[model samples]
Target: MNGPDPSRPCLTPESPPHSRGRSCPPSDQLGNSSSSSATTPATDLDSAVQDNIFAQAPSETSSRPLPIPAANALRHLPSPPLAREACDGGARPSPQRNCCDGRPAACNHRAVSDVCASLPEKSFARHFLTSSGTFPSAAEILKKAAFFNSGNRPHDALLLCNAGLEVYAEDADLWNCKGVTLRALGRLQEALDCCREALRLDPGNTNALNNIGVALKERGELLQAVEHYRASLVANPHQPTCRTNLAVALTDLGTKLKQEKKLQAALVCYTEALTADPTYAPCYYNLGVIHAETDDPHTALQMYREATRLNPSYVEAYNNMGAVCKNLGKLEDAISFYEKALACNANYQMSLSNMAVALTDLGTQQKASEGAK
Candidate 1:
């Protein structure tokens, strides 16, 4: 129980964001949290089974390096933080949310998936001198690398970051981007090292701090990850990614504590996560897990319902709701919930098994009643 939970999707790293093939100050720094404020559609995994949460990467798009702006434009912009990669990179729109509907997640509130941090267009123009020589188009490489990373081409981005470092060896943004790729590749130690290097070069780099937190979180060092997230938030208070990352880490910690039967501590962590980001439905799901474990079926059902409301495609929530309904002797309701679960994910084995059990139980009760009659 002190380790990871068997039935839950482990907390995935919600990476930082960059705009079209360019590093820029985080949108938070530019007072552009609105871009990230859009809701992200939720997907729930059953906590009864452990999945590779950390390895799942969100969708992103390709882009070319935009033109760097003037010095005034560069002054406040920080370097690029971690982002997704793309292949055969060229200009394209941001990653659209195809999960919920035909349109983008940003356009539809219900379809919102976890919207991570992003760089402001204005921030991408930030510039600094390179010791070797000024590569005016160097920032484009980083930007393209980000596009590649978000596009499910981490190896491409990693290679690009390496090539960039060969020329702009002092480029902390390159180092940070490298960390992002390593984390996506499940190279936790290497990713952390990259973040450290980036930090050494640009000690106050927000991207470096967030990337460090990501590596630690992926490594299952929940407390350390929490601290790093706190540091990232302190450095950039308005950063939605930082806040969301912290919430995830705390929820992970709570899950671990819950497994250990440390209910009170687990409750506290879950509460903290909710406080950090109320819109995060996973936190609610985790809370329901706690309540159900404690025999608070009514409250657990409420939480599960809330999770499904927030994320209509939350397969695990439906499965859990079915379980809770069965526990309460609501056999028909349990079957309904289980059917909903199967609707979301036909191959969800737990829901299949739960449905079978509920049906058998109902049959048994029916037989007994007939005999009594």
Candidate 2:
């Protein structure tokens, strides 16, 4: 697949740690500050202000693009695995040989004597020539199709896939690829059909299973999506994308349940996701949010801290950590967390707005306490 377009910059890059006026020691070069003693409110507030001015932006993954492959190369691939087997089953001789009239035989000479049998019989080579016109190989077609799909030309990809199927109709990988392209095109029903066909040909095809799961999820069939995701994981447990997708589906289900006040069930889903991938920062962040919403600020802060520790560049975790600190009346801690988030991502508007609010609160509390003196 082609990389992202060069002209379209999707993500913003983060700033260097030293840019925000914080001297992160060489030991903390990776920004793995999981724990630190709370600083004074004034010091934290000052750092937060500096962070707001110098924070970096989030970077996009796809920045450079590549050219698409040619369609001519795709029409010459080998026949489908099933078609090869059929040819090997003594169904017919090679297509390169001429028959009685110097034309390719539709059926072998042996079958011609039995008119009844011959009427229903067909030669593999004849079928192959009819489908692909004896041209480009299967691998070439798949490559071009993939190139088109990656370049956001799903319709062109689908057309190439269809043309390739004429020669290798029973190729499970081609079917799976077709399904993926169709899914990208938002033709969910067609994508499901393609995936099903692939699965029928190769029951353990993980790509087909994953594509089917995605289609089911898009159609709002959450439970069905779960089944497909589980099957996909069974087929290929090492696929992190599948695990992440399953977690997302579970999280969506949990969200619906939570709206119905099913907090315990939501927690279970979140817990399952964490168990599946402890290093997944989003899961930790979501868990922290849930805990915060449930009025357990201490648990929320701990989760947020864990998330930030795992991924020091997680701006959301830092922002949430600051919010929790503010709620707990730990104004200084909140300011420090907010400043760190701003340092990580300058365009983090929420951190900037909240930092301002926290400063105002700290100032008001300070003046009130001074007045009492």
Top TM-score prediction, candidate number: 2
Candidate 2 all-Cα RMSD: 18.8
lDDT of 2 by residue, 1-373 (tens): 8653322111111112112212221110111111111111112222211110000010111011011111110000000000000000010112232222344313233322232222223632223323554344544455556555544466766766675665456666566667766666657698689878867866776656765775665566767976886887786676554565565555555544555668899788767756654654545655676777777889978877887776677666687687677767888898898899889878676567667777888899999999999
lDDT of each: 0.51, 0.49
Error of 1 at 68 (Å): 26
- Writing each residue's lDDT as its tens digit, candidate 1 over 1-373 gives 2643332311111122222212212111000000111211111212101111121111111001111110000000001111111111111122321212233212222211111112122332221112224332335556656655544566665666665565556666666667766766767688789778867766666656765765665455769978876786676676555565666667657756765768899799879977876755666766776677677889988987886786676666677777777767899998999899789779866667677777888899999999999
Q: Report the lDDT of model 2 for residue 322.
A: 79
RMSDs, each prediction?
Answer: 17.7, 18.8
Candidate 2 positional error at 236, Å: 2.2
Compare the candidates by lDDT and give the number of the best one: 1
Point out where model 1 deviates above 4 Å.
1-134, 148-160, 184-187, 363-373
